[model samples]
Target: MSHPILTEKTVLLNANVKNKEEAVRLAGQLLVDQGCVEPSYIDRMLEREQSLSTYIGNSVAIPHGTEKGKKNILRSGISILQIPGGVDFGDGQMAKILIGIAGKGNEHMEILSKIALVCAEEENVSKMIHARSKGELFSLFDGVN
Candidate 1:
Protein backbone atom coordinates (compact mmCIF):
# COMPACT_ATOMS: atom_id res chain seq x y z
CA MET A 1 0.00 0.00 0.00
CA SER A 2 0.94 3.67 0.22
CA HIS A 3 1.28 6.21 2.98
CA PRO A 4 -1.84 6.72 5.01
CA ILE A 5 -3.81 9.88 4.33
CA LEU A 6 -2.68 11.34 7.66
CA THR A 7 0.13 13.85 7.33
CA GLU A 8 2.28 15.59 9.92
CA LYS A 9 0.32 18.80 9.59
CA THR A 10 -2.90 17.04 10.44
CA VAL A 11 -1.72 15.40 13.68
CA LEU A 12 -2.52 17.44 16.78
CA LEU A 13 -0.76 16.88 20.05
CA ASN A 14 -2.35 17.41 23.45
CA ALA A 15 -5.60 18.80 22.07
CA ASN A 16 -7.79 20.56 24.65
CA VAL A 17 -11.39 19.73 23.90
CA LYS A 18 -14.03 19.34 26.63
CA ASN A 19 -16.38 16.99 24.80
CA LYS A 20 -16.74 14.82 21.76
CA GLU A 21 -18.35 17.62 19.77
CA GLU A 22 -15.47 19.96 20.42
CA ALA A 23 -13.03 17.20 19.59
CA VAL A 24 -14.76 16.50 16.32
CA ARG A 25 -14.87 20.17 15.41
CA LEU A 26 -11.23 20.75 16.30
CA ALA A 27 -10.01 17.83 14.21
CA GLY A 28 -12.44 18.54 11.39
CA GLN A 29 -11.17 22.10 11.31
CA LEU A 30 -7.71 20.72 10.68
CA LEU A 31 -9.10 19.02 7.60
CA VAL A 32 -10.57 22.36 6.55
CA ASP A 33 -7.29 24.13 7.19
CA GLN A 34 -5.63 21.58 4.93
CA GLY A 35 -8.18 22.39 2.22
CA CYS A 36 -9.45 18.83 2.29
CA VAL A 37 -12.99 19.81 3.17
CA GLU A 38 -15.24 22.79 3.72
CA PRO A 39 -15.95 24.38 7.11
CA SER A 40 -19.44 22.90 7.17
CA TYR A 41 -17.82 19.49 7.20
CA ILE A 42 -17.23 19.99 10.89
CA ASP A 43 -20.92 20.18 11.63
CA ARG A 44 -21.59 17.23 9.41
CA MET A 45 -19.01 15.19 11.24
CA LEU A 46 -20.75 16.04 14.49
CA GLU A 47 -24.02 14.90 13.00
CA ARG A 48 -22.46 11.57 12.14
CA GLU A 49 -21.18 11.30 15.69
CA GLN A 50 -24.65 11.98 17.08
CA SER A 51 -26.28 9.36 14.94
CA LEU A 52 -23.64 6.75 15.71
CA SER A 53 -20.64 6.92 17.91
CA THR A 54 -17.40 6.72 15.90
CA TYR A 55 -15.52 5.41 18.88
CA ILE A 56 -13.56 2.51 17.46
CA GLY A 57 -11.60 0.39 19.97
CA ASN A 58 -8.59 1.24 22.16
CA SER A 59 -9.76 4.63 23.35
CA VAL A 60 -9.91 6.03 19.83
CA ALA A 61 -12.67 7.72 17.91
CA ILE A 62 -12.98 7.98 14.16
CA PRO A 63 -15.04 11.07 13.40
CA HIS A 64 -16.09 11.63 9.84
CA GLY A 65 -18.74 13.45 7.87
CA THR A 66 -21.99 11.81 6.87
CA GLU A 67 -22.51 10.53 3.33
CA LYS A 68 -23.93 13.93 2.42
CA GLY A 69 -20.63 15.35 3.63
CA LYS A 70 -18.90 13.94 0.56
CA LYS A 71 -19.85 17.01 -1.45
CA ASN A 72 -17.85 19.23 0.87
CA ILE A 73 -14.57 17.40 0.56
CA LEU A 74 -12.08 18.90 -1.90
CA ARG A 75 -9.40 16.32 -1.23
CA SER A 76 -8.77 13.25 0.88
CA GLY A 77 -6.98 13.25 4.23
CA ILE A 78 -7.23 12.59 7.96
CA SER A 79 -6.81 14.83 11.01
CA ILE A 80 -5.44 13.30 14.18
CA LEU A 81 -6.43 14.79 17.52
CA GLN A 82 -4.64 13.34 20.52
CA ILE A 83 -6.45 14.22 23.68
CA PRO A 84 -4.41 12.76 26.50
CA GLY A 85 -7.08 13.85 28.94
CA GLY A 86 -9.65 11.77 27.09
CA VAL A 87 -13.30 12.56 26.26
CA ASP A 88 -16.47 10.54 26.79
CA PHE A 89 -17.82 9.43 23.41
CA GLY A 90 -21.13 8.22 24.81
CA ASP A 91 -21.61 4.50 25.52
CA GLY A 92 -19.07 5.03 28.27
CA GLN A 93 -16.19 5.06 25.79
CA MET A 94 -13.47 7.59 26.60
CA ALA A 95 -11.64 8.40 23.42
CA LYS A 96 -8.02 9.47 23.71
CA ILE A 97 -7.27 9.59 20.00
CA LEU A 98 -9.58 11.29 17.54
CA ILE A 99 -8.84 10.32 13.95
CA GLY A 100 -11.01 12.59 11.86
CA ILE A 101 -11.20 11.55 8.24
CA ALA A 102 -12.36 13.40 5.12
CA GLY A 103 -12.00 10.98 2.25
CA LYS A 104 -13.00 12.11 -1.23
CA GLY A 105 -13.19 8.62 -2.73
CA ASN A 106 -11.33 5.36 -2.09
CA GLU A 107 -9.24 7.09 0.52
CA HIS A 108 -12.00 6.54 3.06
CA MET A 109 -12.13 2.76 3.08
CA GLU A 110 -8.41 2.51 2.52
CA ILE A 111 -7.50 4.63 5.50
CA LEU A 112 -10.13 3.04 7.69
CA SER A 113 -8.85 -0.43 6.92
CA LYS A 114 -5.29 0.59 7.60
CA ILE A 115 -6.31 2.07 10.91
CA ALA A 116 -8.19 -1.10 11.74
CA LEU A 117 -5.10 -3.15 11.05
CA VAL A 118 -3.04 -0.96 13.35
CA CYS A 119 -5.61 -0.92 16.11
CA ALA A 120 -6.05 -4.66 15.94
CA GLU A 121 -2.89 -5.02 17.95
CA GLU A 122 -3.15 -3.75 21.50
CA GLU A 123 0.48 -2.74 21.55
CA ASN A 124 0.12 -0.64 18.42
CA VAL A 125 -2.89 1.18 19.81
CA SER A 126 -1.03 1.84 23.05
CA LYS A 127 1.87 3.28 21.14
CA MET A 128 -0.44 5.66 19.30
CA ILE A 129 -2.20 6.75 22.48
CA HIS A 130 1.11 7.66 24.06
CA ALA A 131 2.74 9.18 20.98
CA ARG A 132 3.83 12.72 21.87
CA SER A 133 4.90 13.90 18.45
CA LYS A 134 3.74 13.60 14.87
CA GLY A 135 6.73 11.50 13.95
CA GLU A 136 6.01 9.08 16.76
CA LEU A 137 2.37 8.79 15.83
CA PHE A 138 3.14 8.37 12.14
CA SER A 139 5.42 5.50 12.95
CA LEU A 140 2.63 3.57 14.62
CA PHE A 141 0.51 3.54 11.47
CA ASP A 142 0.70 0.28 9.49
CA GLY A 143 0.77 -0.35 5.74
CA VAL A 144 1.86 3.22 5.10
CA ASN A 145 4.66 4.38 2.90
Candidate 2:
Protein backbone atom coordinates (compact mmCIF):
# COMPACT_ATOMS: atom_id res chain seq x y z
CA MET A 1 0.00 0.00 0.00
CA SER A 2 1.13 3.56 -0.65
CA HIS A 3 0.36 4.10 3.01
CA PRO A 4 -0.27 1.50 5.65
CA ILE A 5 -3.90 0.44 6.02
CA LEU A 6 -3.02 -2.22 8.57
CA THR A 7 -0.62 -2.44 11.48
CA GLU A 8 0.64 -5.01 13.96
CA LYS A 9 -2.15 -4.21 16.39
CA THR A 10 -4.75 -4.81 13.71
CA VAL A 11 -3.67 -8.37 13.08
CA LEU A 12 -5.07 -11.24 15.17
CA LEU A 13 -3.35 -14.61 15.30
CA ASN A 14 -5.06 -17.79 16.43
CA ALA A 15 -8.13 -15.75 17.22
CA ASN A 16 -11.07 -17.39 18.88
CA VAL A 17 -14.27 -16.87 16.94
CA LYS A 18 -17.09 -19.35 16.55
CA ASN A 19 -18.32 -18.34 13.09
CA LYS A 20 -18.18 -15.78 10.33
CA GLU A 21 -20.34 -13.28 12.21
CA GLU A 22 -18.11 -13.48 15.26
CA ALA A 23 -15.04 -13.14 13.12
CA VAL A 24 -16.41 -10.05 11.40
CA ARG A 25 -17.31 -8.43 14.71
CA LEU A 26 -13.90 -9.19 16.19
CA ALA A 27 -12.11 -7.70 13.19
CA GLY A 28 -14.50 -4.76 13.02
CA GLN A 29 -14.05 -4.04 16.71
CA LEU A 30 -10.32 -3.88 16.17
CA LEU A 31 -10.88 -1.16 13.59
CA VAL A 32 -13.15 0.63 16.02
CA ASP A 33 -10.58 0.49 18.79
CA GLN A 34 -8.00 1.89 16.43
CA GLY A 35 -10.27 4.88 15.75
CA CYS A 36 -10.75 3.87 12.18
CA VAL A 37 -14.52 3.49 12.36
CA GLU A 38 -17.63 3.77 14.54
CA PRO A 39 -19.12 0.75 16.25
CA SER A 40 -22.00 0.78 13.77
CA TYR A 41 -19.67 -0.12 10.96
CA ILE A 42 -19.83 -3.75 11.94
CA ASP A 43 -23.58 -3.86 11.29
CA ARG A 44 -23.02 -2.48 7.84
CA MET A 45 -20.28 -4.99 7.24
CA LEU A 46 -22.73 -7.74 8.04
CA GLU A 47 -25.27 -6.16 5.72
CA ARG A 48 -22.77 -6.39 2.89
CA GLU A 49 -22.22 -10.02 3.65
CA GLN A 50 -25.96 -10.66 3.39
CA SER A 51 -26.26 -9.01 -0.01
CA LEU A 52 -23.01 -10.16 -1.56
CA SER A 53 -20.30 -12.60 -0.74
CA THR A 54 -16.91 -11.11 0.13
CA TYR A 55 -15.15 -14.38 -0.31
CA ILE A 56 -12.18 -13.79 -2.62
CA GLY A 57 -10.94 -17.38 -2.74
CA ASN A 58 -7.61 -18.70 -1.47
CA SER A 59 -9.50 -19.10 1.81
CA VAL A 60 -9.76 -15.35 2.24
CA ALA A 61 -12.82 -13.15 2.86
CA ILE A 62 -12.85 -9.37 2.76
CA PRO A 63 -15.69 -7.80 4.73
CA HIS A 64 -16.54 -4.15 4.40
CA GLY A 65 -19.34 -1.78 5.31
CA THR A 66 -22.24 -1.13 3.01
CA GLU A 67 -22.74 2.14 1.14
CA LYS A 68 -25.21 3.27 3.81
CA GLY A 69 -22.73 2.37 6.51
CA LYS A 70 -20.05 4.62 5.04
CA LYS A 71 -21.08 7.34 7.45
CA ASN A 72 -19.62 5.36 10.31
CA ILE A 73 -16.11 5.38 8.94
CA LEU A 74 -13.69 7.69 10.70
CA ARG A 75 -10.60 6.80 8.72
CA SER A 76 -9.29 4.35 6.16
CA GLY A 77 -7.98 1.21 7.76
CA ILE A 78 -7.86 -2.56 7.59
CA SER A 79 -7.98 -5.39 10.16
CA ILE A 80 -7.01 -8.99 9.66
CA LEU A 81 -8.06 -12.13 11.53
CA GLN A 82 -6.07 -15.28 10.97
CA ILE A 83 -8.04 -18.38 11.85
CA PRO A 84 -5.84 -21.43 11.82
CA GLY A 85 -8.79 -23.84 11.58
CA GLY A 86 -10.71 -21.67 9.10
CA VAL A 87 -14.31 -20.36 9.23
CA ASP A 88 -17.14 -21.25 6.92
CA PHE A 89 -17.91 -18.14 4.89
CA GLY A 90 -21.14 -19.66 3.65
CA ASP A 91 -21.54 -21.49 0.33
CA GLY A 92 -18.95 -24.03 1.36
CA GLN A 93 -16.13 -21.51 1.11
CA MET A 94 -13.88 -22.16 4.08
CA ALA A 95 -12.13 -18.91 4.92
CA LYS A 96 -8.95 -19.13 6.92
CA ILE A 97 -8.30 -15.41 6.66
CA LEU A 98 -10.91 -12.78 7.41
CA ILE A 99 -10.07 -9.15 6.69
CA GLY A 100 -12.37 -6.45 8.06
CA ILE A 101 -11.97 -3.11 6.30
CA ALA A 102 -13.41 0.35 6.90
CA GLY A 103 -12.20 2.97 4.43
CA LYS A 104 -13.17 6.64 4.47
CA GLY A 105 -13.78 7.06 0.71
CA ASN A 106 -12.17 5.70 -2.40
CA GLU A 107 -9.63 4.27 0.00
CA HIS A 108 -12.05 1.38 0.36
CA MET A 109 -11.35 0.10 -3.10
CA GLU A 110 -7.70 0.91 -2.79
CA ILE A 111 -7.33 -1.22 0.30
CA LEU A 112 -9.38 -4.05 -1.19
CA SER A 113 -7.32 -3.98 -4.38
CA LYS A 114 -4.09 -4.15 -2.46
CA ILE A 115 -5.28 -7.14 -0.45
CA ALA A 116 -6.62 -8.82 -3.58
CA LEU A 117 -3.35 -8.32 -5.38
CA VAL A 118 -1.37 -9.80 -2.51
CA CYS A 119 -3.71 -12.75 -2.17
CA ALA A 120 -3.76 -13.38 -5.89
CA GLU A 121 -0.72 -15.57 -5.55
CA GLU A 122 -1.50 -18.83 -3.82
CA GLU A 123 2.02 -19.00 -2.47
CA ASN A 124 1.79 -15.56 -0.90
CA VAL A 125 -1.62 -16.24 0.56
CA SER A 126 -0.33 -19.44 2.06
CA LYS A 127 2.57 -17.62 3.63
CA MET A 128 0.19 -15.12 5.19
CA ILE A 129 -2.23 -17.75 6.45
CA HIS A 130 0.57 -19.68 8.10
CA ALA A 131 2.63 -16.77 9.36
CA ARG A 132 3.71 -17.49 12.94
CA SER A 133 4.32 -13.93 14.03
CA LYS A 134 3.28 -10.36 13.31
CA GLY A 135 6.74 -9.68 11.93
CA GLU A 136 6.34 -12.55 9.49
CA LEU A 137 2.99 -11.24 8.31
CA PHE A 138 4.42 -7.77 7.87
CA SER A 139 7.32 -9.14 5.89
CA LEU A 140 4.93 -10.90 3.51
CA PHE A 141 2.87 -7.76 2.91
CA ASP A 142 5.83 -5.39 2.83
CA GLY A 143 7.22 -7.02 -0.28
CA VAL A 144 4.01 -6.61 -2.27
CA ASN A 145 2.41 -3.42 -0.93
The best candidate by TM-score is 2
TM-score of 1: 0.92
Per-model TM values vs. the true structure: 0.92, 0.93
Candidate 1 at residue 142, lDDT?
Answer: 36
Clashes per candidate (backbone, < 3 Å): 0, 1
The Cα local distance difference test for each model comes to 0.85, 0.85
Worst 10 residues of 1 by lDDT: 1-10
| Total backbone clashes of candidate 1, pairs 3 or more residues apart or in separate chains | 0
For lDDT, the strongest prediction is 2
Write one digit per residue (lDDT tens) for candidate 1, span 64-96.
999999899888888888898899998788998
The regions of model 1 sitting more than 4 angstroms off are: 1-4
In model 2, which regions exceed 4 Å deviation? 1-3, 143-145
